[model samples]
Target: MAGRAKRLRIHGRVQGVFYRAWTVETARGLGLAGWVRNRADGTVELVARGEAEAIERLIALCREGPPAARVERIVVEAAPDEPAPEPFEKRPTA
Candidate 1:
């Protein structure tokens, strides 16, 4: 099945809390392809490609991140057609 791609910007208590790793695991479980990383401003940014339903589920999960996270808000937008490498990865902080 064809899937949509999206760029997600998660705000609030997302960094330094294993959020990226958690995201990787979650997205992989949903069979998503993309990457996640911490931004300079302490937010988490992720690019995901997968079934719409799975992408939505990943977004919802970001709203309630890892055990130590205190998610405040999430901004989601469509990713460009240029696809990233397959499978999910935790990238270095930007």
Candidate 2:
């Protein structure tokens, strides 16, 4: 079965707070595949692909990121072209 993919642009106090690392751990734990990276604009961007349920779970968790994150909002959209890299990873800042 094909999996679902979503690109998320998280805003507010997300940079330099280990958000990418936290996302990698969370996505991996949820058996997801994709990549997370920090944007130069001070936002955290990630593409998560996996079971639809798992994707939703990941989004919900993202709203309350790690202890250091003060998530203000998350803009999510379909990511039809984003590759599902196995074992999730934190990519270099874009």
lDDT leader: 2
Task: List the global CA lDDT of all models.
Answer: 0.91, 0.92
lDDT of 2 by residue, 1-66 (tens): 259899999999998888889999999999999999988899999999889999999999999999
Minimal lDDT window, size 10, model 2: 80-89
Once all C-alphas are superposed, what RMSD does model 2 give against the true structure? 1.3
Model 1 pairs whose backbones collide? none
TM-score of 1: 0.95
Kindly give the stretch of ten consecutive residues in candidate 1 with the minimal lDDT sum.
81-90
Q: After superposing candidate 1 on the true structure, give the runs of residues whose Cα lies further than 4 Å from its correct spot.
A: none
The C-alpha RMSD in Å for every predicted model, in order, reads: 1.3, 1.3
